[model samples]
Target: MLKRLFKLGLIINPYSGIGGALALKGSDGADIRQQALIRGAEKLSGKRMAIALQALLPLKNELSIYTASGEMGEDILSSMGFNHVVVYQHQAQQTESADTKAAALELIAQAVDLILFAGGDGTARNICEVVENHCPVVGVPAGCKIHSGVYAITPKAAGQVVAQVIKGELVSLMSGEVKDIDETEFRAGRVIAKHYGEMLVPEELRYIQAVKMGGKESDELVLSDIAAHVIELMDDEPDTLFVMGSGSTVDSIMQELGLSNTLLGVDLVRGQQLLANDLTAASLLEHCANKPVKIVLTLIGGQGHILGRGNQQLSPELVKMVSKQNILVVATKSKLQSLQGRPLVSDSGDTTLDEMLVGPIPVITGFHDLVLYSVGSM
Candidate 1:
């Protein structure tokens, strides 16, 4: 194969998902090497790095690489066969956020065409903090929850997008949702998502930008109207589940059903049984086993996020089992009008999950007209 001029930048946060894996309290803080060691696991940023490597390995000889130094920098590049230029090294606690900041800056300084990174929401925020809009960036989902638009749906999907970009394809660089989740709620077993900002996704990119849920805000949306519509749509099937995700709009549905809701937490109601209320991923998955479920959701206002913030209950794996087609969204017409041109957003923590829910899904508010929010809109 002829070599290509694809210049890429990458980074990894070693201590990301271990906390969830080891029952270590949380995804941040512990300071892995800086604080103390637990059970011989030296805090590996390897997971995220490995994902990015898989995306890039196919075109190793064709691209020039810039990366950070140390476990996050040298180890992955060496193992992947790319001779990368190390820009900065991170301390052990140096999670994806720190490394991403360093690598993005280096790529900007080097004026590389693209910066491909590996991490979740925190890492995405770190890059947004410093990324020059002129430099296009993409993310490889490797962290606990990657709700950033910059990431491809799957790590390998990111590689294919890069392949297209370098092949001189007419790719439109669209902004994907830069979403953040509240670490505070995470420990309490609640999902709380907030919009950090936006990132660019080269157009016609697949597996990177999921179907965006809600976007912007409109003065015209009436919560009551959206609620009424959802109530009418419920099949009222004997065993069919009506899992309402967090947000005011879904709350409207709950209100219509005469059931109390978390307002900002996941709620599950099936045939009026209220199977599980304000469920966490563990709880939802346990109970949802082998059952047909219908998720009645609402997109967050302004930032347009449908998941991630307060609905972490919907894990990427769980979402896959549910199938993308199973999701049902409810947003006020005014909210849809407010979207104007921004795509809906979902940071559900998992990039693949984000992709699954990132595009244009149907939004219901009233009887006749439906609102549409697309990943390309923003």
Candidate 2:
């Protein structure tokens, strides 16, 4: 007897994370994508999709893939030697939101069991516009701003979820929120997220990412204490270069140090003074060459992600150069409690670095306060 084939649909937003490494905040508008290209930013949606598709390789004979042509899907499937049919075709050089919507509709028409897409929140919103709750979808995190709950914690994790479904495992379906922020406000260091709608996603608590929590930490005293402790560390290690990451928690620390900060971008500080503002991955490497460096980061509210959410500027190369020991995580105790016992995730896009980042790490919760938390790559 022959085994039934698992029909899977794939969509890759070729320009999804184009603006991340360049510090443009998002790849929303065509103008922003163009600017990112001009600044030498490479589109990583395909690469991220490839990561998610790796786990499906062993089951290729029992799988059938339906996707769009060229960079959106066909190219990747071809390169990976997967059997795929192009249900939709578009100009590979310039794909747009309309293409994504059309592809979603085509996939639905084909009655695919699942639609796996790679991009950030904007891509999720695009799919939500057409598919709604009509089809089950899985998101591969490959965007600059991933505030939606539909995506997996990482690309590889997305593949694992799909693999479970292929093997006829009991995968529960849940409505995942599709959220997106205004790029204009985001570039200005203000986050204005709005709920677009929901989609049916495979429920895997350990794999799926939670919706990003909006607003600042309301506990001013806790933030003050955390800020004071970071300031003390800065004073003790005056010669050490501190790479300040994004988030309200880290911004509060910068406020306490009386230094201007790029709230949504990485900043470099030394001797209690801001060395550079909004440095890209390459620029960060250039500036921190052969210097004693420590990276200070904060968790992404409900998500519990210390890396690979929005701070793509901290490339895997930079993370490796600085080493895990030099990383400092700051979060309020209340913030940590909001996770409901989920381990912090490190989806740095490098599987090896993410694995190396695993294990117990200390988080600064208050002034002279530290809590041990386990970090994992899901």
Clashes of 1: 29
Q: Report the lDDT tens digits of candidate 1 across residue range 291-311.
A: 987777777777777776677
Runs off by more than 4 Å, candidate 1: 1-4, 24-26, 31-37, 40-45, 91-99, 203-378
> What does the lDDT come to for candidate 2?
0.85
Q: Residues 1-378, candidate 2, lDDT per residue (tens digit)?
A: 243366789999999989999889999988999999988898899999999999999999988899999999999999999999999998647788999999999997876767999999999999999888556789999999999999999999999988876765434456689999999998898989999999878753221222124534447777888888888988999999999999999999999889999999999998899999999999999999899999999999888999999899999999999987689899876677787667688989998898777644557776655555557546
TM-score winner? 2
- For model 2 the TM-score comes to 0.54
